[model samples]
Target: MCLNLPQMQSRLLLISPGQSYRLAPYLKAAERLGVSLTIVSDSRYSLTREVADGIQGDFTEPSALLDAIIAQAQTTPFSGVVASDDSTVELAARIATRLGLPTNSIASATLSHRKDLARRQLQAAGLPVPEHWQLDLAREIAPQLQGLPYPVVLKPVSLSASRGVIRANDPDEAAQACRTIARIIAPLSNPIERQTLLIECYLPGQEVALEGLLQQGVFTPLALFDKPDPLTGPYFEETYYITPSRLPDAIQQRIRQTVADACRIYGLHQGPVHAELRIDGNQVWILEIASRTIGGECSRSLDAVLARPLEEYVLAAAMGNPLPVERRSGASGVLMIPIPRAGVLRRINGVQEIRTLPHITDIRISMESGQVVETLPEASSYLGFIYSTADTPQAAEQALRNAHRALDITIDPLLNS
Candidate 1:
């Protein structure tokens, strides 16, 4: 099964390559464009030999990862370097630059990542956001802060997926929250593992995401994802998304413009960007942006929903190729992993109903029997995903829900209240 490299097109370097379970759609899209992707493992890669170029290693140590990418580029002549995960985006930028490739500036890349850095940079750019206070793990405690805002959000600047996010509604909750925060920090496999925590005023509003590309500082805005839940709590786990964002057309324009501005403010030059925002009516606050594609099943959802392959666009954009202007892209939807309590999956029923439903592409389940599921700190547990498309967003929504409702999921309780 030796495939000739000479016939291959784009040689893509995927840093931090892990579960491509979410990368299937992108891989399919790349194939459509005749792009040959090579995954350069960023850490203990579990996928196997066929996953990528097999540059197996970690990206936390920038120099090591940079050297590896350079080595691969020498042979592969990579048209693009993609950091498939949030943690390794910095490494991706360095790799692209070392090869005289297109990517965000190193400083901007780091700032666009790491929530704390992003906040500072955005604030400097005069964007509105939640008020915050940086912490000192050793500090005894601030004495004059008794009158501050309650329901504060304790979040790590580096990690996504609400990894180290906690909420404190009051001083007592804040104290307990502090202990949980300590636990969150102690398990750092690396120094960069959630090292910084910011206790900030929790903004009450709807949370949403903007997924698109920033090329040479010009923004080619794409989809706006609406997470239709109060994602504000202990661990803000995202559960669902709908395209043609529920936000009004005008408001959506503002969000795109704001995101583009944020990218420029952060000095993003190229590559896909995923940004989170909190909006209450017309007033929108910037949450954070990552210099990479939207995580979770989003890339798949977007590809299936839009009828346009995002990975191809990502590859084209990454390589300084032009992508289409944002226009009447079709509709698609996805519901992210949600909390279903702590349990072991027993059986899933009603899947037959999902199959019969129209406008549905796929229903995916990530966990299996005998596997432990935790839903606390917000409904962060995702049982799986349901992808659908339609002539209109409404039709897509109906078909997916019809499929979802027909299914019966039974799980063995692991931790019952």
Candidate 2:
């Protein structure tokens, strides 16, 4: 089946903050769907000569960007407006509303980005959320730390990819973590984004990621990923994602129901939802939910199992087209190569050896040699992604583990820079 949508409009506007691996796939999906896309970006570095219809705008200033989009729409009306990642979600939501395109509301987008607000909304809806306190970065944080439970997590309100997320074991460590995280937040150009941090009691359990879609307030699950590695942390760095989840049927249903409930609580009626949850036996807690698909190259695992590209489904959803929710057969997994140290990347060895392993479908090393690499608690990207598939979840996971062990990575000191 081609997954063709004849009713979708021919033109679209994509708002992306920079050049990312995400752009090429979306462009390919648009081409396959016979849709013309106009790239709207804040940075021109990632825009290539191939993108003939491109616009540069101030992404941080939504009102000005909306005007620019409106002017462009007058010349060529858009069938849909979509954002590639979290940074552009709000802008895309606003543009879509003005153009009468399908999208989540601005309030939904805001809740998706702000952790504190999302937590409050969920808690009020009688949902299970961690006990959390919001600390204003602009004022003294010392007074706010009193009487809170030990072993809390300190993280910036809006940052993603686990950047600036730290675990503090005590009051003293929490204070230091707050100061460190605030310093990380201080240089951000968005002042409103820089002013708050969330202090929440750290839940102890295995983590899982849910990838699904919503259409007119109805939920359709796509895949559920199991994070085999324990994410308990001083700094939580996610490395592995294996799916066709190994959890029992009851647990999986609960996870799905909880995430769907969260969507309703936040008023997110449409688009892809990438959610993080913590589970200990039957008790499940929602960590974070975004109006986007799985982040990074991890989405590749789903692509390997699906008949159509994941981007194609996302694009179809944005156009208000019905998508087949069923996934292709088999167990697939992805390993996000974690950076061991903060330094300059020198070189990666054993790529051929890793690829030759049984059941190893593909491997991509995203960071080039000589690029400065930073690890978790400070950085937002990964070194590369490894993909694998097999008849069983254990076999698929083992294949990824074997492939990961075959390579050697070298990182030079920051002084070399």
Highest lDDT: which candidate?
Answer: 2
- Which digits, one per residue and each the tens of the lDDT, describe model 2 over residues 1-417? 112223445688887866756787788888888778888888767563366478777887777877777777776777787788888888888888888777888999999988999999999999999999988877877788888897899999888888899999888888888888977889877787788889899999899999988889998888899999998889999988999889999999999999999999999988889999999878999999998878647888997678777778888877767668657888999999999899999999989999889989999998999999998788878889999999888999999899888889999989842
| Model 1 per-residue lDDT at 16 | 59
Per residue, candidate 1 scores C-alpha lDDT tens digits across 121-207 of 788779887888776555654442366688788776676777667878887777666666666666655555434567789888898
**For model 1, what is the alpha-carbon lDDT of residue 277?**
91
Candidate 2 Cα outliers beyond 4 Å, as residue runs: 1-8
lDDT of each: 0.72, 0.85
Give candidate 2's whole-model lDDT: 0.85
Q: Candidates' TM-scores?
A: 0.88, 0.95
Query: How does residue 147 of candidate 2 score in lDDT?
Result: 89
Name the regions of candidate 1 deviating beyond 4 angstroms.
1-9, 141-145, 189-193, 325-330, 378-381, 415-417
